[model samples]
Target chain A: MGIEFQNVNKTYPDGTVAVDQFSLHVPSHTSTVLLGSSGCGKTTLLRMVNRMVDPSSGAVLIDDEDVAGVEPVALRRRIGYVMQNSGLLPHRRVIDNIATVSRLNGVAKAAAHRRAHELMETVGLDSALAQRYPGQLSGGQQQRVGVARGLAADPNILLMDEPFGAVDPLVRLELQRELTRIQSELHKTIIFVTHDIDEALTLGDQIVVLKKGGEVAQIGTPQQIVESPADDFVAQFLGLDSARRTLSAAPRDDGGWFVSDAQGRPLGVVDSLPQHPGQNA
Target chain B: MAWILDHLPRILELSLAHLLLAAPAIAAAFLVAVPIAWAANRVRPLREIVVSGTGLLYAVPSLPLFIVLPIILGTGVRDTLNVIVALTIFGLALMVRSAADALDSVDGGVRLASTAVGYSAALRFFTVELPLAGPALLAGLRVVSVSTISLVSVSAVLGVQSLGSLFTDGFERGIVPSIVAGIAFTAVLALLLDLLLVAAGRLTMPWVKGGRR
Candidate 1:
């Protein structure tokens, strides 16, 4: 149900160490984002969850089982991943692209197509687009299809590597909001990777900041990350407006900050941020 | 012109033979070329070897290649099979080059996405790679079709009769109509074949045609 990385390290064949003994746990029904600059190993870390790129040392466990021992295809099928470029197969119809994972899982053609059409609707696409190929869609629409495809198999965990990085700013916001809505409803555990601090703050339930040398700069909720950074590296990496970020850390009546939803419903009282925060806590 | 109209059935028969010879050669070339092209695209070292090897095949004169095969295979020179052999060699070289170019041109993103979506290498080849490369392959096939028609005429040198023989006979007897008929028939057939290829390309590659409404 959750993903755990225990002292995982990745040294490329060229002997460059991208991830150095990194370890973390993403609890079920949460969105954990890996935020960093390019080459900080955020993407590599995400790929390790599904064994797209194997770690040189240590273990990646999904649902308490080491992924190394699982069949790569079966492991991947249970974890949905989205890349920056919505790598839609150019030759397939939009519907067929959405059904890729389901079909891979041995779903019959009729059932797979039916599920694909349903997912297209869930992702805010017109059913008419189902018959069209990926090339016919705009960049934003393509990313929507990518998201739809990722959710096709109902995986317990979703991994996205800058999924909206290629779309226009306006469309990117739309995708972010849609993802938020979907996460609220589906409660799928997600690990999103992005270099943009704004995207990190906007989408992350728990933000893991990676520094240039693949070190853990910080890990916290968006509010905690912005308001009370662990260090200068975290503060710089977050790049939030210092004054606004400080609002949540201002002294409170109960000697603890009262956390609230945007609608002002009190969620909890926190003396200090949890070492690892989960979404909608 | 009067004689051409008078013997339209014979003209039609000649046209049929031309189609029969060229179509099969193009089809055979297409079948052989795709695997060669796929190999060329996948293996970097093999790419040069395959390309140069196919290019060398292309460089060989059609008449000589055709002439040599029958002797090497111990088949008689006058057989239609020899003509098929010659046209296939000519068509295949073009096909290998064109198919390789087409496969190479497939967008890298598409291939990556296919892999991420759980398509194996073979599935990617058949479903994604081949379909996306359809237009290029068709373009190669078009060229092969045209080339086959032109090269198949050389069968006359081996003592088999074709439109080339009609031209030879007409020239020998000073009959201008027969020469004109041969020229017109071959030209018309090539034009029709190309048009058909264009249609097939459009149907197979609706995406390439800008995803027409």
Candidate 2:
């Protein structure tokens, strides 16, 4: 089910404001990315769903029920959360790690492990690795196991906080695609928090572009945000200087400079815009 | 070496006593220190203070602690329990801090992930935090075990028959063989215990063998 935040605010005891009067809705069965720079409180906002961080004021609701009213441990068991560096338990074998939530909820060991083995294939990992410890896996493999663990319990809401931030660029891209494929089939409500705008554009169905102090600078689909920035701040944050980008229909003979990707496949159409002070479109 | 061979049977008896004295103390200490360390880790403000307080206890001369324990615990002066209690105090002193330090050594990322994955506080401690803390905790136990083995001889000064009696009997009668045998056996015992702990650590934490293949 979808999650809704109503005027949530978080102020640490040391007087630093992390999130201030923030509100957003994460629609069900879609990836809604919370995108911003550091100190934007995106992680804090994400953690509030699992009650890892309690908001100072207002309510976070899941399917019309206030999250604050649910027991935190129970709430967390029903939600899946992932973070950067694949946070797998070092002491646990891959299957055991994936089956952690199931085992915690009292699933029999053999049955839980069977589910974990199935999840391995679902996450594109070899079943042979099930008995191996997390320390024996590569970074990409570890991230896959982390995602599998998140999915093992079959939760409807999955919260990923920069889960691929530590992997190589090629591995990161592969994982991003993996996630998209998984989401297409699973249709879980996903709240993805990330600092990279490129990742936000690639993954988010609706990108919540947050500003400092946890304010929403803009929120739109990737295409909408790229086509029409809400303000100079939004444009600047996206590195969209007037000179670098345009939607013009110029040079129709060449189809306005068809943009080819690394493998020379047509990726997008681009047209130059008026120049910015630093560069040109 | 010759003295040890000549008194092999007596040597074996004292060694057994020493083993009984040290092993139970270290085991008791490990059980008690783990919870203390876990508690201390949670109370950040008191973590260093608690660690320091325990460290101070470790420094209290073992001989005095062993000698005075009958007064405090109301046991017979020669009771082996006194030595066990004294060494346990020392073990806790050293190990509480070691356990805390080991727990602290765990990766913050992993610890946070453990919580995020719906692990109850207690479950996380056993399944994630404690296992991850294994290498350092084993290292601490290594130190505690070796020291406890060596300290068992000190109890002989309080009329408890142990390896330390070799030193006493040898010194009083001006007999060098007993002193020599005690020194040799104690060193051998300490080495054996250290190796056992190391083997146990390797067995329990096979993942720490090396980097990922």
Candidate 3:
């Protein structure tokens, strides 16, 4: 259930070093997020767990077994992968799309469909939509189907690559909340890759902030990174120096305190200050 | 008009002969071209070679191909097999390019998703790639079907029996009605086959019809 990347390195055929000496142990039943901007190799590190991209120089072990010894297809079957754009099969109906992995693993058609129906309910999709094609569904609904498909085989390790990146902001927030709800119930080992800082803070129990070439810029809980960035790069990446992070409180005529950013944009109005402000105990 | 009525039975016979030749050639061309197209689509070097090579094949005059195939296939010049083989070659020339384009039209995201979900390369091609490419492939097959039906008439120049024979015989005896009948029948046959391909596409690809997204 736990995944360990032992100094893994990936250099593309075109001489681009996407990942370099990346090592991390993703604890079982926890959500570990790899957070970085584009070209930071966050996705490459996530892919090594399932052998989608084999590491050029080091080993990736799942539950203490090196993945290199396992056949790529067999290894992939046991690992659930969800990608951006809700990569559902356009030709298949929602039920069949969710049932894809179960069928591939040789489950009976009747049982797979039965499980797919259950997963549809689990993902908050209506059973009435099960017979419709993916193209006929909204983007948010399609992503729900993608999540259902990823969980179809009941995989312990789920890799999600910007899984909610393609939807609208409102839908994305809803989906993020749904994932939180699902994870609480399932407790799967999830390795999620994303560039959005807020999303990383919201979902990650352990956040790995990656720099270029898969360098670990910082690795900690959201509070740890926000409170004490390891360096200036981490501080800047998290917008600690920006107006949004430099908030000030002003007395309002209504006796409430107005909290605003350095740019004077009102964030909110607080009824009262904390009783023990700035006190550690 | 009287001449067509007088030779109604003969016209019917020639039409049957025409279907026999064109139908098999169309089916054979599709079966052969898909694998070749898949290979071309997968490899860069093979794609260039196949595109240019098939272009040259298409450029070869059909009369000469009808005559020359007997020497290569070791069949008699007048045999129906020669015409069928010639039509199949012509169909392949067009079909290989179309099939390659059709396969290319499939979405890259969908293809990657299939692999991520544990489909093997071969299984993905038949299940994901091929079905997603269905509408485009059906369009290509329509072009091939119409052209193959029309080109079967060219074999009349090589003395092979088909609907084309009506054209030759009518011209030789100065019968205008026979030539007119031949053109009409060939047009009608092409239209019928094109409609069949469209219907088959609609039946198999239900996802495309009335899809909201």
Candidate 4:
């Protein structure tokens, strides 16, 4: 397991249990999404891995080593984190922000800057904007800078907390695709947190659906989630009612699945199913 | 204007003294106030105490403060230390509040991002927080500088010679020409200092104007 939670719990000082008895094994080298609605403790769970929010009970282990034993600053330098608003430092130039983790890792200034330039290119940012401060960049560009900064030191794991939730629909799609492309090359163990089920379906290798009380409602593949929901809550959450679940998928001449609802309305197409074995494999 | 040329040597001397006295006082104030302001920004009660305390310092009448400085500091009554001490007090009063406000104005999201990205407390304070607070702090510095320049003249009443000495010497001899020269010189000096500060701010903060955002 890349990261494992052994019955972890978190309660705020004011007595709010942000996360309660959460346990999961996130496999290495794949994107595992902790999907939930607001206040479902998805963020709290994600922060625990980096020790930003220490669990109140039990432990969070990375590569079987409990995170609590590590110095927070050192531990954080080894884990890349991105947030919804592209939480970039306003004072630093794009290059400096990207070089941040590398500098913290004891990389020399010139080498860190060189690596930052390369990372900017890796995240699809134009190196021409390297000298400009964060305020000078557009929302999309800033988010790209955030991604570039996250990947600078090249840590084994990356955490994304609502990374694309704030952007426009068009930009969001572009970033999602860009992340997919990056993941194909990097193969880094990524723990992505999102409320959007569609996003989790598109990106996750394994999906953990969280309930309001911070309990795991279901943990399965996207196909498992859509096809056989654990209960009414999971079925309703994915919009997979009894009627829709009855609908079947068949091969299309053009090389995708023709999926329809009970009323034969085209629900969604399965362009490819490197997904469920029962569906096509 | 003719008096300006005739008294150019004296004008230069007083101007140098004026600058010499104000520079150290202003620098001292900046060094002291920044930490106080930063502390105020972080601690809620400190914010109230520091800001209110500084506000009261600004309300202090300059002449009395100058007269009281030697007694408080155990220095010569007419020593230049009196003027320097008084200006330093006024500078700290104005700047501490401004610096605190500057730090507060930095984006919360940005700060959290800094922490998330593995910035140590000290690194984040110096790199992310302080630089972002620059524009507001610079504005505060500009105000402190111009006000300090004008207030330095008020200390001349205590017989600590400065550019304001021109006023005393002119008044004693009934030389209206010398008095006009002093006023003119003071205005020119304040204007020049203000412009220098503005230029420094522009030079330091390139993101304020050049970017297309």
- By lDDT, the best candidate is 3
lDDT of 4 at B145: 88
User: What is candidate 4's TM-score for chain A?
Assistant: 0.88
Write candidate 3's Cα lDDT for A58-100 as tens digits: 9999999999999888788899999999899988899999999
Provide the lDDT at A247 for model 4: 80
Enumerate the candidates' DockQ scores in order: 0.40, 0.69, 0.75, 0.60
lDDT of 4 by residue, A1-281 (tens): 68999999999899999888888999899999999899999999999999889999999999999999999989999999999889987756899889989998899999999999999998999999999988888889999999999999898999999999998989988999999999999999999999888889989999999998688999999999987899988888777775755687878999999888777878778986566667864
lDDT of 4 at B159: 82
Residue A187 Cα positional deviation in candidate 4, in Å, after optimal superposition: 1.4
**Candidate ranking (lDDT, best to worst):** 3, 2, 4, 1
Mark the 10 consecutive residues where model 3 chain A has the least summed lDDT.
Answer: A272-281
- Estimate TM-scores for all models: 0.88, 0.92, 0.96, 0.91
Per-prediction CA RMSD (Å): 6.2, 4.5, 1.8, 3.4
Docking class of 1: acceptable
lDDT of 1 at B89: 78
Tell me, by DockQ, which candidate is best: 3
Candidate 1 residue-wise lDDT, B1-213, digit = tens: 899999888778777877777788889899999998888888988887887687677788767876788887688887777778778877777889899999998988777666665677787789888998898888889888988887777776666776666677778899999988888888888889899889988887777776633
Q: What is the TM-score of chain B in candidate 4?
A: 0.95
Lowest summed lDDT window (length 10), candidate 2 chain B: B204-213
Chain A TM-score for each of the predictions: 0.85, 0.89, 0.95, 0.88
